[model samples]
Every structure is written in C-alpha cells, then in structure tokens.
Target: MIKNYIKLALKLMLRKKYYTALTLVGISFTIMIITVFASFVDQIIGANTPERNRSRMLLLDKVSIYRNGKSTDATPSVHFLQHLPKLESAETVSILKRNEFVSFLNGKTAGHVLQQTDENLWNIADFKFVEGKSYTTDDVKSGARVAVINEKTKEHFFNNEDAEGKSITIYGQAFKVIGVLKSAAAFSKLYGDVYVPYTTDMNLHTTEKAIEGTYSAIILSKSEDARKVRTELRSQMRKIGRNANGADSLKLYPFSSIEQFAKSSSSNDDEPEYGKTTIILLIVMVLFMLIPAISLINLNLSRIGERAEEIGVRKSFGATSGALVKQFIIENVIITLIGGLIGLGMSIYASKLLIQVINSFDPLFKMPTDTFIVSWPVFAFCLFSCLIFGLVSGAYPAWKMSRMNVIYALKGGNSL
Candidate 1:
C-alpha cells in the first residue's frame, strides 16, 4: 500500500509538471534558507579549535565597577586570577591580555597580534603545537622574552623552515621563538599569532587597591560545577567590595557559550536572553516557511478540486476516507522529503561557494571551508521542518477532499 502511494504520487507529480515544479522550488528554497541559518548559528555556538572544551569553560571578559551610581567597564585583574584557584569547583583558571601588535622583522616586516598569558592558559586551551612546546610557569615568573608563534607567523618568518630557537625582533627587542601552533579559525576567541607570558611586561600587573585592570580570566570547570563556581565567585567579589571603602564594587560576568558572549556584547545585562533569542529565531523561520506553505496549500486545494470526479469514483468503490487521507498526506510528505534533500545539497554548494569567494578576496580571514558541518542535530531539525511543512500544506486539502459528497463530486461539482 505504501509503495502504491509513492508510485501514484510520482505519476501525479509528473502529470502536473507546473504545480509540481512550483511546489518543489518553494519548498527547496525555504529549506535551504533554514539550513544555512542553522549552520551559521551552529558554527557560532559549537566548539572548535583551542576552545574545544568550551562547554566546560567559562569566560570572564568584562567586569563592572560601580561607584556612586555610575558604572565603568574594566577587565579582570591579577587579583581575580589569584583568588580563582581557591574555588573547589574550578579545574583550572587562566588569565590573558591582548597586547599591541609588534613589527616582526627578519628580512620583511609583518605586524601580528600578541597575547600575554600564563602557563595555566596552555592547560585550559587546547592549542595544537606544530613544532615546540608552550612556555612554563618558571619562564613566566622569570619574565623570559620567549614567544610561541602560530603557523601563519612561522611561514611568514621562516618560509616553511623550523622556527624553534630562532630569534625574531619585535618592538626593537629580540625574543626567541619557543613554539609554533596549528592554524586556528578566525571565530575562535583564543586564537592569536603569538603568545607570551604575562609577566614579561610589568605594565599588565599595575593594580592598586582597586580590582579592575586590563586582564581577562578564563575558568575551566565541569558543566555540573558551573553553579558552584558562580556562587564562589560572587562571594569572593563581595569580600573584595567590603574593603573598597564605599568607592568601588566589583562584579564578574562569565560567558560560558557564544550565545552568552553575543548577548553581553549586544547589551549591558548580566543575564543573557537565550530563551528569548531562540523563540524569536524559531518564529522567524516558521514565518519564512509558512508563506510558501500557504501558497502550496491553496495550490493543492485547486488541484484536488480538478480531480473531484476521480476521488468520487474511488470513494464509491469502497475507498474509505481514512485511506484517502493517508494517501494524500503520504504523497505531500514524499514531495517535501525530496525537496529537503535538494535543499541540503543546495546549502552545501552555497556554503562552499561563499567560502571560496571570501578566501579569494581576503587571505587574512583564515576561515575553514569545512566549518559548516551537517551534524545529526542539523539533520533532525531539517526533518522536523519538512514534517511541519508537509502537514500544514496537505492537511486541509486532504480533509476537504475526504468529506466530499459522492453525488456532487461525481457530477464535477466543487464544494468545501
């Protein structure tokens, strides 16, 4: 029976080429837009590269210092980093500061962004080394002028040769390259061309009785331990504020996922509106699909009206209304599923083309073409959308046809 339904659906679709083409185009475009949007969002939130342990990590990128009804934005300080180790829930904590890009001159000069971090950051971030090893705590404490360069930096300086123990001049100072890292995507937060110990510069450690400075802390902990970590952090902040003598109060805002980071960047609120953003996105996609679904539904109704005599004849031959409804629903679902496959193919093609175009113009972007992965979650979302589309566009037409009076239907009279 199911095979017959599919066979009949194929025949009918081929018989009405115009309607079939219109429906397929509509469904395919809608699904393609949806899939592309889903893939983009997944790329933003999904873990990659150095931050692969993002699910178990939290970022304290911004701090709020409130004084006399005014608030000032500041980065985390060495004070915060020193206290994070006391938290029982924390696996490891790290601090880093964005440094000025220094000119690297061997034969040619190139500027690269440098990040100053501690040894603990190496443990927290999974930076894949290409040549050597990360700097140690002893090196950081001793203020050694050692640096780790990324793959791009290595090529620019050494031309595919080994970079380890090579002296590179930066900001009129010579530093020895200790390591080289694999390339990281531009979207990654921890990506940098060069990494050095924070203690190499005394300016980053300049802090008075205040707790605000130019440093950001990253907390590495299990997902289950996040609540405890937050609680402990809040308690620690209160303790620091108590000694501030009514001129200062500190707050630690942690962004555990891309969504949180986006919300924080977009607004001044401490809590991210993840649920609201999710609902709004869902509504937008549904509305996007609904426009085409409504048009297809009307088309289905008109097509069913043209086949009134056929439906009437079959009904008179002991074809139950339930069987007719099932067949029509199945036929619509088949059309939608086919459209889904076509849409998936189109999305993949579009993504590749987009990557190629971007890479052609901007070599410095460093974006991976394979970043848009079609994971199981994406596949499931596509199937769910297809099912909703099938039912919305087919249900009313099938029900109306099922309830038609045999006498009127046989006489070529249309009624709803």
Candidate 2:
C-alpha cells in the first residue's frame, strides 16, 4: 500500500513537470543562499584563529579632564610602557607601535609602516611561519635589524623567489629578512604585512635611545584568570597614578571583553546586520518553500477528491483514518527526501561557486584549504530543515482528505 502511494506521488509529480521543477529550484536556491552566507560569516569571525577562541584583551587609559568648558583629549602617554607593573600570572609582554610611515627597500616608495613587536609576539597570537624563524630575546637585546614579511609582502617584493635572508632597506637602513609569515585572513583584525623588532626599528627611525619606555604594551596571561588579573592590574595602575578627583584612571580588558568591544565599535559600512539580516533571510526562505509546498498540498487535495470513490471503498472495507493519514505522510516524506538529495548536490555546487568568487577577488583569499570540503553536520542540517518543511506542508491536506464521509464520498459529488 505504501509503495502504491509513492508510485502515485511520482506519477502526479511527473504529470505536473513544470510545478515539480519550480518546487525543486526554490528549495535548492534558498539552501544555497543560506549556506554561502553561513560559510562567509564563519570565515570572518574565525579569521585569525578557530571560532572557539575568538576572544582577546586590550588595555587602555581611562583618564579624562575638562578644560575651557570642554572635555580635553588626554590619554596615557605612549611612555606608559616603562611603568607597566609586573603581574605574577603574566606569560610575556609585547610592546607595539603602529603606522610610522617609513621607507621600504626601494627609495621610490616610503609610505609603509612597521608593526613593531617583541620576540615572543608569535606565542601570544597564532602566527604561522612560512620561512626562517621568529625573533629571539637576543635579537631584541642586540637591537638587530631583522624583520618578518607576510605572504602579501613576499609576493609583492620578491615575486616567485625566496624572501628569507633578503636584505630590504627601510627608512635608509638595511634590515635582514629573518622570517616570512603565512597569509592571514583578509578580515583579520591583527593584520600586518611586515613585522619588525620593536626596539630595533624604533632606534633606527627615531632619535630616542630606548623605545621600551614609550611603546604600547600587551601583557599575555597564562591562565583563564584574566578577569581577576585585569582587576588587579587596573588597581595597581590606579594606585600608581590618580586623577585630581581621586578616581581610578586606568582601563583593563579581558580576552572575551575585547571581542565584544570590537563587534560594537566596528564600522557599519560593511558589517553584517546579523539580527535583522538573518531573520529576514530565514523568513524569505520559508516563504519560498511555502509557496511550492502550498501548491503540492492543493495538488494532493485535488487528487484525493478524484479518488473519493476509492477512499470510500477502502473505508467501507475497514481502512482507518489513522492508516490513511500515515500512508499519505509516508508518501510525502519519500518525495521530499528525494528532493533533499538533489538539493544537497545543488548546495555543493553552490559552495564551489562561492569559493571561486571569493578567490577571484584576491589570490590570498582562498577558501580554507584545511577541511574545506563540506561536512556531515551541514548535510544533516539541510536534510532536517527540508524534512520539517515537507512534513508540515503535507500534513493538513492529508488529514483533511482522510476525514471524508465514506457514504457521501462513494456517491462522488465533490465530497471534499
């Protein structure tokens, strides 16, 4: 009996080929759009590292004073680096100074800036080495003119040749390339095409004798007790320096806190309106799925009306309403499951097309090479969503057809 229902469903679909094609296309297109956007958001948020550890901490100065009836733009001097209180739980401290606009190897261009950092900088963040090794404590102490170039810089300068051990003149000083870093995600916040020894680069560019006293410091904590340490650090800084009103003027942030700050402070130009955009997309997709599902339900109702005499014969021969509803549901599930498989194939092709478009924008913008292929979780999600839509849409018509009056249905005068 179940087999007969499937046969009838297939025959019905084939009889209305245009409607069946439209339904399949609608489901496939909606799934494609959702999957592509999901992959994109995953890539953006998971830019520097894996999604699970998407948190980082940032410290700032909280002091502000009013002058001439307006708030003054007072911030902690960059020289505050020298006064950073040593926390027992801190692993390493890295000093950074950005956007100095110094000259590179060629004298013709002099607009690039060095992102200065200490030797253990890579340990704090996941920095992949493509060539040579990262800086060491000795390099910092000796004020070595060594630098690390990112993949983009390598391609730009050296082209196809090896970038390591190459001497590049920056700000009229020659610096050796001791390392080359792999390309980072385009949307990453911690982006630098070139990294130089903090103290060394500072000495060459400025007349200052010691840069450790003036650079911004990042203190890395070894454990998850970041919040406690943050509180302690802020208290320590406040104890060392206070405003006129005796209020704490130091700011502290934990690893998780920084990410939230970044999200809120992000520019609205290209940012995804996660809440409204996702809700709107889901609503539109559901509506797209509904239209065809409604058509299928109407088709089923018409077929059941034509088979009213047969349904009456079955009821007279002892078929229960429950049995009839079950048969119809099973038939719809089979059709939906078949459509889902096709939709899965469509999703794969769509993912590939999306990857191509992204890569075409820039060579470094390739889809994640590791685990780039679709996973079982994605497949399962698509299948589950498809089944739910199928079941809900098919239920009403099946239930209505099953409740027909047997004697009246047998008389066959549009009983439904």
Candidate 3:
C-alpha cells in the first residue's frame, strides 16, 4: 500500500515538473540557511578543543565592589587570590593575567598578547602542545623567565624550527621558550602568542592589601560539583567584603558555561542565556519554515483540485475518505523527505563556501577548523521538522479533497 502511494506520488511529481522543482528549491534553501547558522553557533559554544573541560569548568573574570551603593568593576586582585577560601568541590584551581605587549625578534617589533598563569592553568585548560611541555608551578613560584609560544608565533619568529630552548625578547627581557602550542580558537579567552608565569610579572603580584586588581581565576570540577563550588566561592567573597573597606558589598559571578559567561559578561545575571536564545531561535526557524510550507500547501490545494474527477471516480469505486487522505499525506511526506535530503547537502556545501569567502577576504579571519558538524541529534531534528512541515501542509488539503461531493466532482466544477 505504501509502495503504491510512493509510485503515484513520484508520477504526479514528474507530471508537474516545474511546480515540484520550485517547491523543492524553496524548502531546501530555507532548511540550508537554518542548519548552517545553527552549525556555526554550535561550534562557537560547543566545540571541545580549546576549552576541552568547559563543561566542568567555571570562570571568574570580574569582581564588583559597592561603596555607598556605587559599584565599581575590576579584575580580582592578588590579595583575593592569596586569601581565597579552599573550595571543597574543585579539583583544580588556576589564575591568569593577560596583557598586550611588544616583543622584539631580529630587530623587528611585533605586538603580542601574553597570558601570565600558574602551572594549574595548564592542567585546567587543555592546550595541545606541538613540542616540549608546560612550565611547572616551581618555575612560576621561582619567577623563571620561561615562555610558551603558539604555533603562529613559533613560525613567525623561528621559521617553524625547533622552538624549545630558544630565547625571545618580550618587554625588553629575554625569556627562554619552553613550549610550543597548537593554535587555539580565535574567540578563545586563553588564546595568546606567549604564555608565562604570573610570578614573573611584578605588576600583577604586588603586595597590595586590596580585593580588586587584574586577575582571573579558573575552577575545574565535575559537572555535579559546580553548585557546591559556586556556593563556596560566594561565601568566601562575603567574608572578604566584611573586612575590606568600601567593599562591604561585593559580588562574584562565576560562569560555568559559555552561555552563562556571555550572560554574565553582558549583564550581572548568573543564569544561562543560551536556553532563552535557543527558544527564540526555534520560534524564528518555525516562522521561517511556515512561509515555504504555506506555499507548498497552496500548490498542493491547486493540484488536488485538478484531481477532483479522479477523487470522484475513486469514491465511486468505494474508496474510503480515510484511505485517500492517507495516500495524499504520504505523497506530501515523500516530497518533504526528498527536499530535506537536498537541504542537508546544500547546508554543508554552503557552510564551506561561507568559510572560504570570509577567509579570502581576510586571511587572519581564521575560524576554528573542523568545528562545524551536523551531529546526529541535529540531523534527527531536521528530519523531524520535515515530517511536521509535511503533515501541516498536507493534512488540510488532503482532508478537503477527500470530502468533495462525488456528483459535483464528477461534473468537473468547483465543489466549494
């Protein structure tokens, strides 16, 4: 029975070649646009290479100090780091201080962003090493002028030769190159040309009895331990506020995920924003899909109207309205499934084209490679959406045609 319906659907599609082509193109393009956009967004937030442990990591980049109800924002200070309470739930704790500075190589000056961090930063944030290894906590505490450079920096300064044990002058000081790392995501917070120890920077580790300065902390823990870690961090902040002058009201926002980080960065909220953005995106996609679906429905209604005589003949031959409705619905679903497959292909091709175009315009506009993928769940959602579009656009037209008066349909006149 399904086979007969599919054969008839194919024949009818072939008979109206122009309409079928138009419908497929419209549906496929719409799906392609949505899927590609979704893929890029997923890559930006869900990619697991740079922030490999992002799911189990929490970032505290900013601190808020309230004096007479006027709030001031700054990075956490060395004092805060020194006095921070022990977190029972965190497995690893790391701190970082990043700044842009000029480095001299072969009498050429180049600006590079440098991250000053401890050995814990290496264990918490996964950085792929091309050669050598990360600096140790002993190196950090002893104020060793050792550095780790990324692949780009290594290529630019050393002609991609062995970077280990080489010395590069940063900020008028020579630092031994101890490690070379693979390139990180362009948008990653940890991205830098040079990584060195925080203790090596006298400015960051000054003996200041303040709770606000230039420092960020990373907490790594299990997914289930996130709440407990946050709670302990907040308790510590409150304790610090009680003793610090003009900082009696202090707020610490620990971002557990990219979505939460974005929200906290944009506002003071601690709740995740991705869930809200997801709902908005779904609503928008549904609205976008509706336009093409409406067009398909109108085309189906016209085509079904032309088949009124066939319906009458089938009715005369004792065909049930339910069976006719089912047949037409199946035909629509077949068309939709085919369109969905075409759309999936188009989406993948378009994403590659888009990346090429952007990169051509600017070579430095490097997006993360091998990040975009149409995962199984996304593909399944696409097929499910196709089914919904088919049913919505097909059902009313099928029901309407099936209920036509037999005698009027036979006369080939408008039944309505």
Candidate 4:
C-alpha cells in the first residue's frame, strides 16, 4: 500500500508540473534559509574541534567589577583566576589570554589572533595537529617562546609550507612555531590563529593582583555537574572572590557552549538569559516556516480540488477517509524530503565556500569553522522537521476533501 502511494504521489506530482515545481522551489528556499542559520548557530553551540568536550565543559569569559563608583568590564583577572572556586566536578581547568599580534609577512604587516595558555588547555582540548606537537609543561614553566599555528596562519605567512620549527616574529620577538593545527573552529575561548605559552607574557607575571585582565578560564567536568558548578561558583565568589582593591562587587558566570553563545551579549551582573534565548530561537524558526507552511496548505487544497472527480470515484468505491489522508500525507512527505535534501546540499556547499572566503579575512572577523556536519542526528532533525511540515499542511486538507459526499464531489462542488 505504501509503495502504491509513493507511485501515485509521483504520478500526481508529475501531472501538475508547474505546481510541483513551484512547491518544491518554495520549500527548498525556506529550508535552505533555516538550515544555513541553524548551521551557524550549531557551530557556536555544537561540539567542534578543540572544544570537543563542549557538553562536559564550562567557559568563564567576561567579568564585571565596580569600585569607588567606577565600573569596568573585561575578561576575568589574575585575582579571580587565583581565587577561582574549586569546582568539585572539575576534571581540569585551563586559563587563556587572547592578544592581537602583528607580524611582518612578505614585507607587509599581517595581524593574527594569538592565544596564550597554560599547559592545562592542552589537556582539555584535543587540537588536531598536522605537524609536530603541543607545548609541554617544561616549555610553559621555562617561559619558552614556542607557538602553535593554524593552517590559515601557516598559509598566510609561510605559503602553506612547513611552519613547525620555524621562527615567526611578533612585536620584535621571534617565537618558534612548535606545532601546526588543522582547521579549527573559531569564536571561542580556545579560538586563535596562533597559540603560545602564557609564561612568556611577563606583564602577567606581576606580583600585584588585579580585578580585570585578559584572562579567561575553561573547566571540564561531567555534563550533569554544570548546575552544581554554577551554583557553587556563585556562592563561592560572593564569599571570597571579591574585596580586591576596594572592589566590593564583582560579577561573572560560567556557561556551556550553547549557553555561552546565548548569553554572550547579556550583562554579567545578572544570571544569563538561557530560557529567553531558547524561546527567541524557537519563535524565529516558527516564524520563518509559517509563510511556507501556509502556502503548502493552500497548494494541497488546490490539488485536491483538481482531483475532486478522482476522489469522488474512489469514495464511491468504499475508499476510507483515513486511507486517503495517509496517502496525501505520504505524497507531501516525499515532496518535502526532496526539498530538504536540496536545501541541505546547498547549505553544505555554501559552508565550504564560506570557509574558504572567511579564511582570507580571519582574526579580523572569525567565521564559525566546519559548520553543517552531516551526522545521523542532524539529518534526522531535518527529516523530522520535513515530516512536520508535510503532515501539518496536508493532513487536514486531505481529510476534509476526502470526506466530501460522492455526489457533491462528482458535481465539482469544492466547498471545504
């Protein structure tokens, strides 16, 4: 029965060539827009390179402090770093600093985003290395000027040649590139074109403690431990993380990858708006599909009208309304699946092209790396969404038209 439904669906679709073309095009355009947007959001919130421990990790990126009525906002400081509350579930914690480094490349100035880190970062992040290895504990302890660079940095400066074991000059200091990373996801605490040891930055070696600095932290823990971690962090900070240099107030929040993106722009003084962000995304997706869904419903009704005589004949032969509804929904599903596949293919292609284009202007504006992964779960999500559109648009109209009296339908009276 299902096989017959598919054949009939295809026949009906081909019979109205223009209508099928228009419906497929509309669905493809709508799904394409949704997929592109969702893919980018996925890059920020989904598991990716370096931060593959996304669900098991929390990032502390920004801090807010108030002292003598002066408000300052920046990355967490050495003071907060030193006083960081011990998270009971923490497996490892890493401290990182980001800086813009200017280097002379082919007699022209090139800027790179650099990450300075302790050895712990390497433990939490599994950076894919194309050449050499990451810095060791000894190198960071001895303040060795060693660096790890991304492929884009390698290509920009060394013309895609071997970068490991070669010195790259930044701010009159030559740091030997120790490792070369494959393409990595950007726009995170771990994001950078070049990476080096934090000990080499002598400015951070200051004996005096401060409230704000260019330092951020990432803590790896069990997925279920996030609530406890956040709760303890708030409690511990209020008790001991303050009172530095007369700054009686300080604010910071720890977030998972998805929460981090959602709360990226919210004020640190309050709890992150996780619920609000989720609601907004749901609303946006519903609104985006609303128009396409209405069009599909109307199109289904029109198609039913054109086949009123056929429906009447089938009804007279004792065809059940349920059977007719199921058949129409199946037909709708087939059409929606085709549109979905086309949209997804276009999204994957666009993402690849965008990656190449984004690399040319990277560190200035970092694009999410390697978006639109074709995993079973992702594909299933697309399929499920397609099914929803198919059922919603086709089921009711199919049922109503299928239930029309044989006499009324045969007379070409389309009143539903």
Best by lDDT: 3
Q: Which ten residues in a row have the lowest lDDT in candidate 4?
A: 363-372
Each model's C-alpha lDDT?
Answer: 0.77, 0.61, 0.78, 0.76
Preferred candidate (TM-score higher): 1 or 2: 1
How big is the positional error of residue 130 in model 3, measured in Å on the Cα after superposition? 5.7
Model 2 lDDT tens row, 285-338:
577567767776776677676668877887899989998787678767766776
What's each prediction's clash count?
0, 0, 0, 0
CA RMSD of all predictions:
4.1, 7.3, 4.4, 3.0
Clash pairs of candidate 4? none
**Maximum-TM-score candidate:** 4
lDDT by residue for model 1 (7-105), tens: 999998899889788889999988888887776666556666677788777878777778987888777676556554366778888888776564634
Candidate 3 lDDT, 304-405, residue by residue in tens: 668888888988998899999998899999888888889988888887777667767755434434334565656777778888888988998999889989
Which ten-residue region of model 2 has the weakest summed lDDT?
Answer: 205-214
Which pairs of residues have clashing backbones in candidate 3?
none
Q: Which prediction has more favorable lDDT, 2 or 4?
A: 4
Candidate 2 to truth, TM: 0.60
Cα deviation in Å at residue 334, candidate 1? 1.7
Instruction: Sort by lDDT, best first.
Output: 3, 1, 4, 2
